[model samples]
Target: MEHAKPLLNYIRKHVTLSEEEEVFLCSKIDYRKYLKGQYILQQGDISTTQCFILSGCTKMFFVDNDGQEHIVMFSIEDWWTSDLGSFVSQTPSDFNVQCLEASEVIQFPYETIESLFEGIPKLERFFRKIIEQAFVASQKRIIQNFSLSAKERYQLFHSKYPQIEQRIPQYMLASYLGFTKEFLSKVKKELLKP
Candidate 1:
């Protein structure tokens, strides 16, 4: 189906799948669409499915005790998103994953994904690599937050994901970088100066 290609391509990048394995994987996944402002997963709910973006963007964030929304990450096409802790443990999620644009995703239900590893042994290796990469990225972000200045962080984010800056709002981007909106504006202004 149309929704399967991106995910298959992504999986191929990590591990090769046989034709039978590909068909088996596709049969187990569900293709879904979300409208702008709709939530794929919400805070306080168990994240039973992991969504792999086929198109559009989403932001994963949580509301603090004061009701402030703190963005954790913004995801676009080709990214896999879910509350990892909640999905893995079958516990309530601490974050909300909301679509920022009309979007399509391939949903891999937790049980189905687990079962796939048994039927298609290579999938276990693929998933393990995906988790390891995600963990490493999380570690890198923590280090950067502590060591990099706001301006430096902004520059690095921009350089790495130039496309994302154009898709998301400034305030959301600022939040992901651990900077206040006003601070982000000042940083942008400073960068623009000769």
Candidate 2:
């Protein structure tokens, strides 16, 4: 019931749901509490569940051949996260999803989601819209990487996730922005100038 509110509100943003539908959906949701640095999904593991963050933060990242971690995205409260490629296809994931802070998430297993879609067709539209938004965000990040200066990228990131900036480690933030920690500090100093 407590976890239902956030998930219900998020879904309702993209689709209208009746009370019965809401109750049914909530019944299938499972909650998990993750400690900071704990992994939700690991590279090469199959992701069996999609999660909605009820509280705290998570980072989706991958280790490159050089053994460097590359952050693909971060999710905070009210955001959904999963290795969609793995969840949908039942294949190994290419990314690792880890908690950045002590976090609570509501999870929907892949089979449960499929069942929901089969029973509630409108839910499909809701998920489609969610995917569309994620795709657009990914495209924007790609464009920013190509077209924006490091400072500009930092500014964009700061503006979009001001709260997150203060919470995550500086080194992790630097990784997300594709810069070294020292470089990010320099950029911050420049931004602070009168």
Which candidate wins on TM-score?
1
CA lDDT, candidate 2, residue 183: 100
In Å, residue 32's CA in model 2 sits off its true spot by 1.2
Tens-digit per-residue lDDT, 1-194, candidate 2? 78678888888888998888888888877989999999999999999999999999999999999999999899999998999989989999999999999999999898799789877789999989988998999899999999999999999999989999988999999999998999999999999999
TM-score of 2: 0.97
Model 1 over residues 18-44: C-alpha lDDT tens digits? 999999999999999999999999999
TM-score of 1: 0.98
Off by over 4 Å in 1: none
Off by over 4 Å in 2: none
RMSD of each: 0.8, 1.0
- Provide the TM-score for each candidate, comma-separated: 0.98, 0.97
